[model samples]
Target: MSGALQPPSRSGVRIAGDLYQWLVAWHGCVTVLRDQTLRPANPIVAIGVEADGAGNLDDVIFYRAQPPNSYEQVKYAVDSATPVNEDYLLSPSPTGGPSILAKIAAAWRSLTASGSQVDLALVTNRHPDPGDPLIRDRDSRTQLLLPKAGVHGPRSDRGKARQRWAVGAGVSEQELLELLGVLRFDLGRDPQHLRELVQLLMLAAGLRYEDHAIDAGADWVARMVRDGYKTLSLDLIEKAVQDLDLKQGPARAVLSIATLKPDPVADQADWSLDWTDRFDGATAYSKRRPKAPATWAQLQADIEAAPMFLRGKTDIAVTGSLRQAPAFCTGAAFRMVSGADLAILQRGQVWSTSADYEAATPAIVEHSLGQGPDLAVAIAVATDPTTDILRYLRDQQLSVGSLLVLAPPAGGAKDNSIPDASTANALAVGIRDAVRETVRTAPHVHLFLAGPLGLALLLGHRWNRIRPTTVYEDVATADFYEPAFFIDA
Candidate 1:
């Protein structure tokens, strides 16, 4: 939706709505093909044929054997526009002859005559029509009782047209009635469905649009269709980049054909996505990185693999220099693991919080504000006194037990300094045993973490494994803390 489109003049803006409407219908059919249950039944082999774009039908869904698959026409009308109704079934178009109803009949007839079975669907973005023949389907009825007049028993010119359509399709009135059973009318009023479409398109496009621009995904699809693409492809996004016309900038640029140099270290990562908290705080740190392939196929795969909700029990890592670690964790920590990246990380260790660990924790500490019936233990793992945070929790009246594990007395200098991985492992073991000793007396644990990043990661990794825990980081402002973003079990 953020990508460029043809210049937006007054006319283009007006036409955009209509184009988007058609795209919605078209994408609707494409979605059906993606559904495992519906696709196995409908089995769309080809779609959006040349005849469809020429206005013969909005789309022709093909099947393995023949004609009785499906023909769909998607229509949209704004508040001021005319609503779609059964009248279109018999009415004549501006070019004369039969209207939408006649055309659908003709397509059905043609496909049936060719030894195919087909059904007609009129998908509309308008309000549900009470008078619609298919309204009974809304009542959860499995079958539609065919009416005698407009569809099957018309005696006038409209009836004559159906007769002609029947003859052209080589099907009798009874066969037509049987086909009518498959006729569908999908009224579009559910905002949830529209949201799903927007999400699906985001997966297909591999780009995040502003919330207001979700509907614009359809417009992008329509552009791909209008550009003479017969089938949807992941490459259309790249073409969109080339076709973009930025009216508010330099209109022309000098062009020189040149060969691009290959990267010395090719990036193997294929996709990217992020999750945020209600406060507009990102789970991961804000940092720039090399781009990955921005293709729809990869995006779709990524969306399918995304966790439905961030789970509880996770880990976070912070650099030692990030003195205000909790605040950084609040807005800057992130975890993004792609199919390729996951493979690499499993084979080795990678130490960047922004890219590898954004999805590992809850985005904010407020997620635990009222998350208690059980008593909580606030454990501060640091060298110095954590009285500020402890006092703040007490002042806030969060009923919880508290413990402070000060640096060991008469310990080695490394005990006070940042510990290495092995030392962090030993420290993590000690912390886990202490927590195990405490949780037996309490029900839950809320952590106030200090000390080195290695220690934090090691402790978090182990604690999260033991049980789901709430981990907090210290922010810059006095007496404030933010939750670490590691909530998975």
Candidate 2:
């Protein structure tokens, strides 16, 4: 799955390497499509794979006949921390073939023999060694070698290094300079980030970003490569996309608020908020709570800043271990009035909140604790926290007239009760509707939610026509619940 986290140096090197190559090609292919949002103005017009005739490299990017065709050498590294230093580039392959830098220089020397415009790229998921002078001297973005002064002077360390590289490539300093002049060291994102980027590209191209669709695309690309398909064009790619049924409806980029340990899977989210610092990890799957109530305010500010910076991209898929009042506040932050498409990735499935129109209306159960000016609504959609809610109420001495306990029709609500987005949205809206009736009577309401984060978010999204609500979180402890965000809308 493109949305899942890939293994770190897992077994089956052949398949993994091949898949990485295809992913690179597919990314290029998607961006090169006309009018694609991610597309550059001068996108590579065509792609080549194992194209010895086209160019002696792993892949090739052919531009219109004018000049400067790009030859790429794709390197897939199993170890992410491994750096591409002088020793690594100078070292020969297992079969004692020429070193990577030598081969690249040799090809560069050959192609530019006629003085035709050309460029070489070493595309990989590895970074250059910052400590090594040669690799560090080059620009990170341009990847062009820029030796320091006195580099060419005899006996200088940089000079000796340059001489070693020039001798290794069977070329003079001038010849090496020519190669460096046009070379680009394109250090791409790591495996998981790369796949998420690919998915976003697919979404931008009206192509499906679902796991099945991406898998099918990968399989198709692998088959295409095996079949020796060279000179790939847009027409051919469009046909492949159509034949593979990769077309999809409109959608905006997803902003994932990973409040837990990072999302473990490859989700098709473009922007991400990694809030792993908020919690201490118990295991790979379990996490502890935030240290303080101010953390909630900081979280709200963080959530509030997302839409402000995202500009035209607000439609999103919410996921992660963020739950309860925090989740509800997330929905409240990007609420119903935003008019953005919203979905939740929960428990390996994606449920859209917009499907509530066809959902079964859930029954709401309300209670009157006492007569006061304020209201406290305790929802037990995923679990019951009535006892704790009462404890917090008594401890805080909130002037609450009534306490409304909202649940599903069976008078029971747990994580599994709300099966789909439709039911979840219905239940969320039902709770909101039930709260609206009390909003007219009470000047303020204290909202305490206990449910799946998805349900809380949905309720918050539809939470309009409500009172000045102070949403609470069980941050300190279950017995020590505290107020978090004081949302007026």
Candidate with top TM-score is 2
**Candidate 2 backbone collisions, by pair:** 3-266, 4-266, 370-401, 372-401
Q: Each model's number of backbone clashes?
A: 31, 4
The candidate that achieves the highest lDDT relative to the unseen native structure: 2
Per-model RMSD to reference:
18.0, 8.5
Runs with alpha carbons beyond 4 Å of true place in candidate 2: 1-35, 38-205, 209-211, 230-236, 256-258, 261-295, 310-314, 317-321, 363-368, 476-480
Q: Taking the tens digit of each residue's C-alpha lDDT, what string does model 2 give over 373-420?
A: 898998887877787888778777789977888887667767788777
Q: After superposition, how far is residue 221 of candidate 2 from its true place, in Å?
A: 1.4
Estimate every model's Cα lDDT from 0 to 1. 0.40, 0.71
Q: What TM-score does structure 1 among the candidates reach?
A: 0.39
Candidate 2 weakest ten by summed lDDT: 261-270
Per-residue lDDT value at 329 in model 2: 79
